[model samples]
Target: MSDVNQASQTLLDSNPASQRIPPSVFLLTGAVAVIGSNSLVLSPIAPEVAQSLGVSVPMVMSGTAAFGLGTAASALFLARHIDRIGAWRMLRIAFMLLTASLLVSAAAPVAFVLVAAQLGAGVAAGVALPAIYASAAAIAPPGRESKTVGIVLTGWTLSLVAGVSISAVLADWLDWRAVYGAVFLLAAGAFAVLVFNGHRDKVSTEPAALPLAALTIVGVRPLLLACGAFMTAFYGVYAYLGDHLHSVLGLPISANGLVTLVYGLGFGAAAFLDSLEKRVSPRLGLPAAFLAVALVYLLMAMENGTYGAILALAFLWGLANHLGLNLLIVRLTALEPGRRGAIMGLNSAVTYLAVFAGPLGFGWLYTTAGFGALAGLAVVLMVVAILAAYAAPSTPRN
Candidate 1:
C-alpha cells in the first residue's frame, strides 16, 4: 500500500468503529470553507454590491482591501493568543464573530457599512485560519499529516468552486444581500457544529510567542518570507487575470468564469498528489514545487498572447500552487508544535499583507509595461521563494 493508504489502514485498525476520516477534520474543513468563501466571494459580485450601495466599483473593491488590512493586522497582533487560549476556543470565537459580521454585512445600509462589516470578518478570519491549521495538525493521526492538511486546504477549492459561483447566481437572482446572507448561514452552521461536536483543548500554561519572538524560532523567517513571495506572486497575477481576459482577449465574462472553474478543478486535483510527499523529504519536495511555480510564471510571461495557452497555464499554476502551499503549511506546522498558532499566524499575516500589496505593485507594472512584465515579476518572486525554501532549516516529520 502507498504510505497514505497504509496510514489509513493503521488508523482503521486502531479504531474499528470510527470512520477513516475523523468528524473533527470535516468540521475544521467546514470552518476553513467559511473563511475561504468570505475572502473570495466579493469579486464576482462587485458590480451588484456597487450598484446596491450607490458607489463606484473601485469603492466596492476597497472593502476587499479593508478586509485584507484587518486580517493582516489581527494575524500579526492577536493570533498569538491561540496557543495560550487553545485553538478550539479561538476557532469558536472566530465563528461567532464571523456570523455576526456576515449578518451586519447582509444588512448594511451603505458601502462604508459593508466595508466595516467585512473588516470585522477579516479580523475574525485572521485568528480563525491559524487556529484551524493548528487544530488540523494537532488532530492528524501519525503519518497522515500531509493527507489531512491537504484535505482541509481543499476548503479553498470549495470556496473557488461553490462559493464564488453560488454568490454570483444569488446576486443575479435574488440580490447581492443574499450572497452575504448565505455566507452568514454557513458561518452560523459551522459555529453550531463546533459548539456541539468539537473537542476542547486543555489551555496551555505556556505563554504564546509574540510576533517578533516567533521570528526567532528556527526556519520561521525564511519560511514566512517564502510565503510572502508565493502569495504576492499569486495575488498579483490573479488580480488582473480577468481584466486581461476581458479587455485584451475580448473573452466574455462567462469565459473568464470558466477559467476560474478550471483553476479550481486543478487545485482540487492536486489533493491526490499530497500523499506522494510522504515518501519524499519536504526539503526536496518544497523546492521542486516552488520551481514548478517559477516555470509556470515564465511560461505565462512568454505566452501571454494566446487564450488557449493562458487557460492551460492557469491549471498548471493552480496545481503547482497547491503543492507549494501544502508543503509550506506542513513544514511550518512541524517546526515548533507548541508554537504553531503563532507561526501560522505569521503565515496568514504575510499572506494578507501580500493580498493588500501585490495588486498595487503589479498594477503599476502592468500599466506602465504590460502583462508580460507583470508575469515576469511573478517569476522573479517565485525564484525568491525557491531560494528561501532551499536555505530554510529542516522540519521534523509528523
Candidate 2:
C-alpha cells in the first residue's frame, strides 16, 4: 500500500497541471501574456511606429501580415519539433529568439527592419505557444485539463487589453519602441525563471516525421479544419471590430475601447466551460459551441442599430470562441497524446493562415455588401465548422 501511494504521487507529479496553479504554470501563462501582448503591440501603435520609422501607417500596418506569415511558416516546419526538443527547453530557446527580435525592433533603422523583427517575433510565438499550451494541458489534473488550458489561454484575451491600452499609454509617454523594450524585459525574466526551476521534462518517444504527416490522420484533420473555419469566422469581424463599430454600429471612438474590454472579459469566461466538458464529451461540446457562435455572428450581422444587441453578441462571441478554441486543442491532444506538439503546430498554422484571410475577406465584404453581409459570411463558415467539429473524435471524461 505504501508503495502504491508512492507510485500514485509520482504519477500525479508527472501529470500536466496536476498540482493546481503551480508557480511554473503561472509564470508560463505570464510569459505567454507578454508574448500575446507584443504580437498585437504594433497594431495599436502603428501610427507611432510609422512616424518613428519615417513611413506611412499603411506601410507599418503591413507588418501584421509579416507576423502572420512568419507564424504560419514556423508552425508548419519548426513547431513540429517540440516533442523532441521538450517544452521547457523549447520555451527557453523561444524566449531567446523573442528577446533578440524585440531588441532588434527597438533599434530598427527603418520600416524594413521593423517588419523583419516582427516576423521573427511571430516565429518565436508560433514555436513557443504550441509547446506552452500542450505542456500546460498535459500537466493538468486528470479531469481539469480543459480548465488548465483555459487558464493559460486567458493570456490571449488579456492581451487585447494589455497590448492595446498599455502600449498606447507607453507610446504617448515614450516612443513605441519603449513598448517592445519593456516586452523584452518581461520575456527575459520569464526565461530566467525557467532556467532556475530545475524541472526536467521527459522527451516524447514518437518518431520525428510523425508531426508532419499528422494532417492526413482521422483524429487530427477534421478538427484542424473546424478550427480553421471557426477562427476565420470569429476573427473576420473581430479584427475589424473597432472600425466596424465606429462605422457600422455608429459607436463613438471613445466607447469602442470599452466595448472590446467587455468582449475580452467574456472570452475569459470560457474557463468555466470545463464544467460543461466534464458533463459532456468535448466532441459534442465543441459542435454545440460552434452552433452557438453561428447564431451570435448571424445576429450581429442582421441587427446593426440596436446598441444592446451588438454588445450582447460581441460578448457572447468571445465566450463561445473561448470554448471552441480550448476544446479543439484539448481534443487534438487527446486524439494523439504522443503528437501533442505536432497537432498544436498544425492548429497554430491553420489559425495564423486563417487569421490573415479573415481580415482581408471580411474587410472586403464590409466594404462592398456592408456589415450584414460580412456577418452572413461568418455564419456560412460557421455552419461548415459545426459539421467539422461534429466529425472530430470524442473522448469521455475519466
Provide the lowest-lDDT 10-residue window in model 2.
251-260
**lDDT (tens digit, per residue) of candidate 2 on 41-112:** 665566567768888654665566577777778887888888887988888888888888888988888999
The prediction achieving the highest lDDT against the true structure is: 1
The C-alpha lDDT values of all candidates are 0.83, 0.75
Q: What is the lDDT of residue 21 in candidate 1?
A: 59
Q: Name the lDDT value of residue 111 in candidate 2.
A: 91
Give me the displacement of residue 100 in model 2, in angstroms.
2.5
> In model 2, how many backbone clashes occur?
6
Roughly what TM-score does model 1 have, to 2 decimal places? Answer: 0.89
Q: Kindly report which residue pairs in candidate 1 clash with one another.
A: none
Backbone clashes under 3 angstroms, per model: 0, 6
User: What are the C-alpha RMSDs, in order, of all predicted structures?
Assistant: 4.4, 3.7
